[model samples]
Target: MFKRNIFICLFLALVISCGGDGKEMISLHPMQEKMAYADHETIMLELNEVSGLNHHMPKSLLIIHQYLNNETTSGFITNDLSVLTTDKVQISTINDSSILILEPSNNRLIQYDIEINSYEIISDQGRGPGDLYFAEELSTFNDKAFVGMQGFQLSIFDCSMDLCVYEKTINTDFNNYSIDATEDQIYVLGISPFGNPQDSDPLNSDHNLFHILNYQGDVLNSFHPAYDDRSPLVRNRLSSGGMIKTYSNKSLILIAFDFFPYLYEYEAGGDLTNIFQIDNFVQPIYESKESLHSGFSAGLIYGNKTVIDLTTRVDDEWLFLRLYERRNIGFDHVNVTFTGDEWYTYLAYNVERRELYKLGDDIKTTPGDSRVLHVLDQGIMVNNDGKLKYITR
Candidate 1:
């Protein structure tokens, strides 16, 4: 039997939405790091640049859902995986070996074997010691699976065994938005527990957005990522925090903030390696403190209102970033639509060339709901409906 309430409580414990109680807009300070590049090399993104990413992606990479059997799903939610929410589905691509999916909705972990063209449920859902409670992320190290729990717990299971058992549970006082592990330690990225009455104000708190802990959950190190300190109001909102993902094969972790159009890269052991930024991205202009506290009403007022959110995807050679730009598309408050009023911009950075290129809408419009599920060497994997789709290069 499964404890469904475990996931519900875990979800409520974590899932910190990105929003601001402050009325001011955070200032834009794109990456200002200095490094060497080839002669006449362009690193900064131009406002009118044409990325042309689709020119490279194969129109139809390979849809895996069609290969999967959905005719019978008695023990599952539905036979169709295509309808699952991509954002809620956590993916760990194993190149051509296999792909791992952690579906929190039903609390099940599925393994899609690439060569065999079949999938299996590997991890069972439960709130008990060995069971998975709100498994938001999964990564492998030395053939073992590390499951990131939303409820401030990190569980390591013996993946080499046919039936994985809980090896240990690492406890923390903070909620984990995302987690990754190396041979030596476990790393997580998330926000301070600001909503907790016991937690201090973010601006006054000493904790950083990133944390490094050993297998025993001992805090080895932490880093205070740069913040948009233009004003206290904006800084507080920026403090709501963001997510970080690791490219273990590349020994890199990509970080994206909830407030801006930039990406920060760090080496596995907590070192700032690179700062990538897109300068032309839209930034909200806050004229005064009155505008800073505007809240939802601000999105309604007349003016060129701009809002930005960042999401990132990566492969060995490239780091892909998606920016959702929303604006007030009406002449006035009359006949205005808020939820569906938005456009997307995709930017990819070549690791070898260190250049930023905009991707085409066809390729940019990935099959998934939010970020690409996985970035493989030859293609990208996305969850279309609930089916797995791979867009080949």
Candidate 2:
């Protein structure tokens, strides 16, 4: 039955790629290197100017960008103490004072008051908030925030009152690398330390794991799908890591490792209902694009190969998939952009249709020479640069 289901999925995917009525079609131009996909009425945020702030820049900075309606804004946090960095920096409604700024460079979790521009240190525990989500399931009835930790745990913050309260911890065996939450449930993804400890070997037994937990902190379900061991026709084995996204009602989507290009969809009960496998469509005749910069590669991984990061948009209709390809010794980074529209389609980097649109003019070098630009509703964010910047979109 599983083999039959897999065959059917492959056939349907091929048909969908061939212009099936149910699938959305995207085409890429040869000159255009990266392409951003969105709904027909998608709002485009063009870069205006990099904003200047009077605050002091810290050694380590993290900016969270948020966009709503016509307003775009960002919150800035840094590890430097010489300067009094606001716990929250409001891009819009600066006078309205809807932004909260947190302080204490060493605190793991900080709470902010947007209206007063005040923030309080919530918890010094855990590895800080790597990924945060406002819980819909628990929020409707109570005030709560979900924080995923790099130390393999989830921290719940009770926000029902004026001052948010830090709750206890829910422990899991897997390293909780990334997290996302909907109203009723939280989604966590992590790598198995015992399986794939070494970075060089791709064949490590570490299986990408996903967990679904309810507001009561109950383990609803756990998923660990087997990676495809078959070698790709061209590329080396692909490894999977990074954030997982869930919908308001508890629907889930996650990326998997192994060069096969796999995206899995699971139910709230933790049952795997559908799987999308991306096949590298090869052309019989092809020419290599000249590299402008060399020697630079995506820094996240060791090899010269590219690494991918996936984030879902607010609408939950489209997935923002960014590909970072490292150049040779002296070259800059090359980023190829792609989006997966349907629920069951895996994103492929070289797939012409999924490439990201180039910025300004077409300039080709290596991956390291250039950076990937992201335009949120509020401002512009650049990936290659170490710190996140927010500007008018």
Highest lDDT: give the candidate number. Answer: 1
TM-score, one value per model: 0.61, 0.46
RMSD (Cα, Å) for all candidates, in order, is 12.0, 15.3
CA displacement after TM-score superposition, residue 345 of candidate 1 (Å): 3.5
lDDT agreement of model 2 with the native? 0.35
Model 2 spans > 4 angstroms off: 1-107, 110-121, 125-143, 160-164, 190-208, 226-240, 249-252, 256-260, 273-303, 331-388
Q: Per model, state how many residue pairs clash.
A: 11, 44
Show the lowest summed lDDT stretch of 10 residues, model 1: 31-40
Candidate 2 per-residue C-alpha lDDT over 46-93 given as tens digits, one digit per residue, 9 for 90 to 100? 222213311421111102212211223334322211223322221111
The runs of at least 3 residues in candidate 1 whose Cα sits more than 4 Å from the true structure, single-residue gaps closed, are 1-43, 46-87, 95-97, 104-107, 114-118, 140-142, 161-166, 195-203, 225-241, 246-253, 267-274, 284-315, 327-343, 362-374, 391-393
lDDT of 1 by residue, 22-52 (tens): 4333223221221111111223444433324
| TM-score of model 2 (CA atoms) | 0.46
- Residue 364 lDDT, candidate 1, scale 0-100: 27
